[model samples]
Target chain A: MPIDIDISHVARLARLALDDDQLELYRRQLGVILEHAARVQALDTEGVEPTGHPLGFTNAFRDDEVRPSLDREVVLAEAPEERDGYFVVPPALEGP
Target chain B: MSLADLTITEAARGLRERRFSSRELVDAVLERAAQTEAELHAYLTLDHEGARRAADQADEELASGTDRGPLHGIPIALKDNLCTSGVETTCASQILAGYHPPYDATAVRRLREAGAVPVGKTNLDEFAMGSSTENSAYGPTRNPWDPDRVPGGSSGGSAAAVAAGSALGALGSDTGGSIRQPASLCGLVGVKPTYGLVSRYGLVAFASSLDQIGPLARTVEDAIAILEAIAGHDPADATSWAGEVPDFRAELGRGVEGLRIGTVTELSGDGYEPAVSEAVASMVAELEARGARVEEVSLPTFDVALSAYYLIAPAEASANLARFDGVRYGLRVPGATTEEMMARTRAEGFGPEVIRRILLGTYALSAGYYDAFYGQAHRVRTLIARDFARAYERVDVLVSPTSPTVAFPIGERTEDPLAMYLSDICTIPSNLAGHPAISIPIGLDDAGLPIGFQVMAPALAEPLLFRVAAEVERIAGFDARPTGVAP
Candidate 1:
């Protein structure tokens, strides 16, 4: 089956910026991968439960207790932009 | 033997006996790493001074009669994906180029507690995605057996370091076949422990459910020692198994007597290189001679494992890797808007292969297509696990060639992602089933390159897996070393 990939839409969701040429490249490559993956759909999976975790464990919980945390200075040291003990990011809202 | 040549077991013994100090061992390993760095490209950052300091501390502790266990003072390498506090932990991606984790990965922390000196961080395929190390941002690690050929990856550097004697052993994470395939090509032993047997707390997330940290070593015992040290419950990771970590060393010498070893008929037939098939067959015959009941078992869904893995791994990777968006840590490409900054940072920071996978993953999990792709793959995973469950009813463990073909030339499959994905065909089933699997050097191929034979057992059955692996290792008796490497 030929796969019609909305490369731009998918890249946007993935937080990736692909130029036109690169989008064209991925359009072909991802099509091949998806075409191959499409074979799994042919197998009758009716009543077969999907396994999200191989070991079948669910809802692992621990005690709600305090523990040592990374030092604020050390954690903040890795940030590209930091001010007043907080990470600085691009504006959350555009200028009015 | 030279200090660099000592296996973890030998080095530990030497240190205990005071025959050689940890400093001598670390210096010799550093020297070997420096000499081979240009040709092998095995290490991204060698912790020369740090390793020296740790070695001195270990020596002082030993002198002061505070002996840590088997790994004390033994030099080993960590795959760059595992977090190392105060040290750079790049996943071979420019996005994480200078990111220093605030804390060591639980596995690395355990190794430190055991007194294993961190010699360096080894190279890998970016984000541990590709089969060959060609995807590494630093550069591909060359196969030590043949410098021109590729070292099967994404744990290529870890395998190469152990094979080249640069480190006594090294840890590598296997999402699909990263650890086993590379160890096979490099002629060393590699283990992908039962998923969750070792904590994934600080392993940079890549397909979290499937990714597992394990060891590559010059000998089965050495690998077991590393595994024992690293395995067990860690409250830090929710999925970490809260179970007993068995004495892997004690289980080693238990011969595979009366063991029902199954050979996957599908994996052994045509499509495999003759040398790989022959090596695996010879090992099976040897096991039979040693009283193992060898039988041929079939997993009809085996052929679709690679397809399922490509879908499932990428689907999870898409979600897991969404954390690298420029704000908190890693590379930041400033922009007018947060979305633009994320896009630009990701585009510039990640390599082509990584971007390709992200695109594939994003599309797989997108609306209107999720059921057809990701959901279907998960159903296939259930079928594959059912196949293993059925097969294990009659067989104690299963065997196959670790990789379908031996190491190819460095750039042979770089252009074709599907071709690159095929390299893990034989090793993916275990990861999907969350089983423990091991790869041991079976023998050499026609070109004198090493071939790996894989043995896989059910989850939490590493003792059985190691027992069978030890038998294969003994029968194969592969003692050949990579040429031009003095050990």
Candidate 2:
């Protein structure tokens, strides 16, 4: 069965704006890939634990020591838009 | 022979013996790069001045008897995805066109500390998402073997650079065969170390769990040297292994006598090209003749590795790539609102394959589909890892053809994403299991393109990989270079 995915809605969630062509193209392409991916569902994985990483280790803590960070000006210089020592961005809310 | 064509081992020996200066080596490599670059499109950024300055410094240090080990003065290429501080480190995506990272990736820093000359940043699939370098927003890198064929990517540019004698060696990240597949296709030795063996601190994340940085070089010894220099724990990357990394170069010459080698049943047989199958058989025969016991081991879960990889890697990528919003570094398309600006910037900046993966990833992790897709895929990952655990119980290492076919002509699979993904079938399982695997060029196929033979070992068993790969390298004697490229 083909997956019924709302491409536009998913794109919105992904913070991507898909044009009409991209939406149609991706819908078809993703359908084929997902169809192949459905093969994973054929196996009985009941009670089998999931693996998030290859080596199952966690919490690699470092000493609580302050290290030098990237220069603020150097970082902001690469930003697409920047103000005085801050990244400039469009407003979060729509204008009244 | 030209200094550009020397392997890392040969180059290091020459440097030590005073046969050639680092300046001479860097110059020859840059000149050769100038010769073949237009035809191959291997390097996205060639740091000629930086390379010369580094080489001169290495010479000066060596003159003062302040050596920094084997890589000192060796010209090495880096995949564009590995961030180089103060350099334009584009992952071949338009979004990062003007982005200059403030910090070096841990692996690159390690290489630099060892006095390795940075030749340039090689291209890759944008965000390291595609099988072929064709997914690169800049353009596809051609195979040095045949200009019409692909160099097998997302590490295509790195592979091409090494194969064309533009760089002695290179660093490439393998998410799902990005390093090994291209290495196989380009006829070089490529390694994807155990997941956490090398730090991922500077690498642009594709799938954090699967991404690993390793070497692409002309010889197994060279690959081992590069791996040794870069492998070890880094506090910046919490996922980095904190265990002692064995001296792989010291163990490389141990030979494969009496080593248990298993030929994975699922990765071979009917589906592969006859030449590729013959290469695998030849590898088995050679190893068996050398007293290595070979057997066909069944890893049934390997059958679903591709399916599981497609879902799981994309799911992880979706979350990891969320950092590319327009507010920070890279391209920003203006919009009336912040959300619209991010959306527009992404739509305009990322290439088709990157966009496709992000979309696929988003859908898989979406509310209603998470359990069926992303969650199920993780369980499948567990199955693959369990399969490897069982197989490794019986064999010291596993062997298979790195890819099903030699480098195919460019544009052949660009339109078919499934066909492109299928090329990674043999190499994906190892990535899923987070094991160390290396691809050694056994010989050239009938078409004269190089054929890669893969050897996989359990996690952190890079020493074993080097040992077996060294034996294979010795046995195969694969010395053929690209046709038109004269040393």
Candidate 3:
């Protein structure tokens, strides 16, 4: 694991704001984690096919069924912020 | 009645004997849940009125001798992911914050039919993504033993509720150790049913191929009892197995005397804290003393399986989560255009961790990187499976530390996602190999956190898994985690 990191790049990607203390903290922690990951990279996976899932079964599906459904009013009742029989959302776009 | 100490089995027995009614048990559990929720943050929603209504019906059914099964009149909680109709199934992410499944998950439906009352939906890491429950969009599910620490996740809430005696038994799903890790941290018996032993019809997908639903209880018998109630083929689920379900409880203590228990050299090594290692070591010794052969086996691929799991799980998650684009059933943000609505809905709905994994997964599965990452991961996965197959040929069951160490403080590994993911090192291989595993409390650490010893076996070897696990727990006795609060 490299000691150096492109903190600015990661911040840009994650939309995070990091100060010196935070950067140092993440750097130390991420380094150890990466070091551990580097050890895993050393294994002989030469002939081993990387497993996609523990259960080798693929293309699992549920039968199409019209089962008993939840009451709309009852389910809508648990919403923390609901109005007009629907979930209200905060603004997605900022006003100019 | 004291609510915190009642096991579901005891409550059910009493309910049947006419000593008490299910409504009374429901009230007691609700009272305990109220007591714990404020401090523990273990529950996201508590439907006390709903539970009472169901329990009332259960009482009426028992009075008429229409007893459902072992789970009749029992109160159990669901990890947030298992969708229950008329109940919120958030998976601890804002993206699905107000989401209610249109119908019950197959497992949820089965439990309800078995007369198990749905107590409440518990907390979890967002989308079952983190090892600790801290990543939950709402809040961390605190450890029942030490309020300052975490109940290992992503079923941490279910584990904590059982640990705190809020419910008798609960359902938790394991994908890369979600159930066992939390169960170990909270000191309970947690089982991961073989891949197809239980249907995954309504579990909100994390990694579809590896996900499984199982029982989390305070006792092996209780777990087996619950498994018996729920384990069966579901025509609804294509992956559901057609094999006849075994009577797990009847097989318990059926003589592990000659069971070929295999101890993985990779897990039982210096990497473990001396105390954690000692506890599992003692368990292996006890197995031998019980007339079992504990042989050392190799899972050389376990070293790199975590990396493969990380890649595969996230890659699958990115695809699985694409459904939540705000149009279908979840909270959607209206926009001037379709693409903006999709983008803004995801941006607003998904918590940080969910987005992080989506991005990581998308990157890994991106065209240029598919062969180098996801494809390679699949091949490596097959090799790990082969390793287990060969080892199982020589041994009946495999054992290891459920976790590398005991529960850490709540915020210990939160800042670094990679570090937290590595904590699944012992659990990922089983998921990779598609095997059945159980995490049973075996010992305690210096801080009094509980240690878990995991017993795993080849596919459909749950009966053998239980035989070995129950014996280990029977021998080790309970290594109590400090419950600073009284029920």
TM-score against native, each model: 0.98, 0.99, 0.88
> Model 2: runs farther than 4 Å from truth?
B484-487
Candidate 1 residues lying further than 4 Å off, grouped into runs, are B484-487
Candidate 3 or 2, higher TM-score: 2
DockQ of each: 0.87, 0.89, 0.22
Question: Order of candidates by DockQ, top first?
Answer: 2, 1, 3
Better structure of 1 and 3 per TM-score: 1
Interface RMSD of each: 0.9, 0.8, 6.0
Candidate 2 per-residue lDDT over residues B265-308, each given as its tens digit: 89977769999999889879989998999999999999899999
Cα lDDT tens digits for candidate 3, B150-267:
8999999999988887788899999899999999988899999888889899988898888999989988888988898789999777878876876675567676788888888877
Report backbone clashes per prediction.
Answer: 0, 1, 13
On residues B348-390, what C-alpha lDDT tens digit does candidate 1 reach at each position?
Answer: 9999998998889999999999999999999999999999999
Q: Which 10 consecutive residues of model 2 chain B have the lowest summed lDDT?
A: B478-487
